[model samples]
Target: MSRALGIYIHVPFCKQKCVYCDFYSLPRREDQMDAYAAALRSQLFETDFSGCEADTVYFGGGTPSYLGPRRLAALLEAVFAACPIAPGAEITLEANPDSAGDPDALSALRRAGFNRVSLGMQSADDGELKSIGRVHTMAQVRSAVEAARKAGFDNLSLDLIYGLPGQDLPRWRKNLSA
Candidate 1:
């Protein structure tokens, strides 16, 4: 199979930054969101996607889903305008469970053309989540997953981290089983 080009958009905002994470992200600033979106649009428009058809478009960063559905849609539109995204192209958005507020938001994101939603669940254990400075509880992760599924997103993926401080194989297995 031939390799295809992938486009990545960074959304540098999060509800709260995890202690283990060193990505480019800040707490949500309402005033800066619009400006950031505009800047992203301009950057997308000015860039060239010559000689490449993007087979995948990934929104990754501190938290792409933090931008909410309307802004995410606008960003997707700008990306589509910039290049020809292959039919059935895998478009994935990285989201934190703590940040996924309402089911309607996920539905709106689906309407915006995102077929895949990747949630940063990190761990299924509440203690592990707290130890990692993740603002979400295990219940929140379950809720987020249910919300995503209800929003018609079947291609959902969850991120998990192992080998954390004081974590053991048994704990990892339990987490994985959960």
Candidate 2:
């Protein structure tokens, strides 16, 4: 019996660095994208997966969607070329709504084989969004979600933060309701 494995890719870029974020990320640098993509391809090629059959490929990080559609497509191509991903593999990408304000990016991601998308919505209230320094507004988050659905992504997840400075149960419930 062959053991199924998982592949995880980390994209370390964001449109803007958040105040409370402590992840590996840098502000968007268009010049660095191509070089970073090449490095990622090289890394995938160098990695040995001789006995592993990947059943899942997760693109995570400071903001995987920060790479946009083109880079993400290139990276996915390189990964597929490097390994044999199982049929019906769960390919997921983490995104920040602010970074993914463009609907075309989400469409391209779905076309490139990502079946799942995780969005960092953080909060549903305008004040909370501002307090957390999230670049996107609550309206933007809703729009992003709608865009993802329109892009044919049925498996979508949103990330919310609890235990925030002023977040009480009511706020949390309201967020949940939204």
Candidate 3:
């Protein structure tokens, strides 16, 4: 019998680089999006997944949401074509609030087989977010959550950062509560 595998797709592009990020990623390279998508799809289609079934597919990286719905959908389509996905598979996309807080885009992603979203909330406090070079604000986070819910995403997660350079206990607590 074949084994069920958890697939992780890495997107190495971002709108801008974060000060504290050490990940190997390209920032401010929107021009390469189409080329990157095409290359990724070619790679996915050429991979050998002979006896494996994808039970979970996670799209993570510099900010998967930066790719937008159409590009993401195309990549996901390639994944579907190349692999045998199990029924009710968990397909997750790691998104940034700024780029993903749109009802229409979220709906498109949902229709493209993304069942879960991990939003990079970082911090609810705008100051902390700026300190870390995150472009999204608390308001955007809220909007993203609402949009995700409206798009029929039941499985949603948030990514938070604590203990920044000037972050105090009170501020951290506020982040936890907000």
Candidate 4:
């Protein structure tokens, strides 16, 4: 039996760097987006993906949605042209609720073949989100989830983190229970 292959695409663009985050991400440069997309396409074309089929394609980083629709579509086109993603494959994109919660953004993602979205919910408590330099509120996360659902995405994932300031055991338990 042949093993399934997965594509991991890193989008190193963030609105602002988080103190807790140590990932490789930089600020978004609108002027460089096209060049970066071209570079990615060139690299994908150069890769030797002959027999192995891609069962999953994940776009992770500071925030994938920061690229907006057009650039992301171009990248997706390159992925489709260079590698064969199996039918019904999981195409995931990591996004922050602040930017990706809107209906238009979610719809654009769905149209571009993103079947799943990993939203960085961080915590259910708004204070925790604020303390972590996250601009979006928990309400925004809920709204984003609803928007994603409305956008026809059935496979939705939320990223939650523990050990924030002022978080007691009971508070954590309450957070989990909510």
Colliding pairs, model 2: none
- In Å, residue 45's CA in model 3 sits off its true spot by 1.3
**Candidate 3 lDDT (Cα, 0 to 1):** 0.93
**lDDT of candidate 4 over 97-167, digit per residue (tens):** 88777788788878988899999888888888888988788888888888889898899998878788888
Whose TM-score is higher: candidate 1's or candidate 2's?
A: 1
TM-score of 2: 0.94
Q: Who is ahead in TM-score, 2 or 4?
A: 2
| Candidate of highest lDDT | 3
What order do you get sorting by lDDT, best first?
3, 1, 2, 4
Better of 1 and 3 by TM-score: 3
Q: Name model 1 segments beyond 4 Å from true.
A: 1-3
Quote each prediction's TM-score. 0.94, 0.94, 0.96, 0.92
**Cα lDDT of model 1 by residue, 87-115, tens digit:** 89999989888667578999988888899
Question: How high is the lDDT of residue 93 in model 3?
Answer: 99
- C-alpha RMSD by candidate, in order: 1.8, 1.3, 1.0, 1.6
Regions of model 3 farther than 4 Å from truth: none
**Of candidates 3 and 2, the better by TM-score:** 3
